[model samples]
Target: MKEIQHRSDCPIAFSLDYLGDKWVLLILRDLIFTSKSSYGDFLNSNEKIATNILADRLKLLEANGFIKSSVSPEKKNKFIYNLTEKGIDLIPVIVELMIWGSKYDSYDVKDVVKKLGKDKEGTIRQLREKLSARINSDVPSNE
Candidate 1:
């Protein structure tokens, strides 16, 4: 990973230095919520991200230890992307973003927000556990 120069010691600035781009968050959103794992799948998302941007974001995500890529077992030519533990730890951040957006954005997210009502912490815990289990199981053992 390349050394990133932080403008300040503040944590928010540090985080934004790596993840300030809209594309980065959106890609993370797809990984966390959807079953997207391939280059084509990301390209096909509704955001219509440019190929160059998608390629760049994927590389950056991988370089930053947030994601890992492996060749598909069934399809030798295809690659599958999975979240690392570091990435899994960001689930709560993503969920908080969702909650914030639902409240402020014009789009109707009432259904989703209603589902998350009053138990935000519990919801975060459940999502973390589920995703952690899935990610751990997907990793190959050294033994």
Candidate 2:
């Protein structure tokens, strides 16, 4: 991994250095909430991110330890992207954003918002557990 220069000592600044861009967050959102994993899947996202920018952001995310990529078994030339523990840790942030967006932007996330409103911590825990299982499932056990 290449060394990243910090703009400031603040935690928010450090996090923003990696996640300040809309595209990066959107990509992370897709990884967490959608079944989209391949480059093509991401290209088909509603945001319609440009190929060049998508490629760049994917590379950055992998380099920064937020995501990892593995060659597809069915198509060796293609890669499947997955979230790392670091990326999975951002789930709460994304959920909060969803709740806020539902309230202000009037997004159609009412079902999720309602669940979160009833049990925010439990919802987040379930999400993390599911995601953690997915991530762990992708790895081979040493046993």
Candidate closest to the true structure, highest lDDT:
2
Clashing pairs in 1: none
What candidate 2 gets wrong by more than 4 Å, as runs, is 1-4, 138-143
Candidate 2 per-residue lDDT, tens place, 1-143, comes to 23467899999999988988899999998998888888999999989999999999998999888888877767778888888899999999999888878888855656767999999999889888877876777543211
Please give the distance, in angstroms, between residue 125's alpha carbon in candidate 1 and its true position after superposition.
Answer: 1.7
TM-scores of the candidates in the order shown: 0.86, 0.88
lDDT, candidates in the order shown: 0.81, 0.85
Candidate 1 lDDT by residue in tens digits, 1-143: 34467899999998998788899899998888778878899999999999998988888888888888877777778777878889989988888888888878998776546667778787778767876776777544212
- Estimate the TM-score for candidate 2: 0.88
44 Cα displacement, candidate 2 (Å) = 0.7
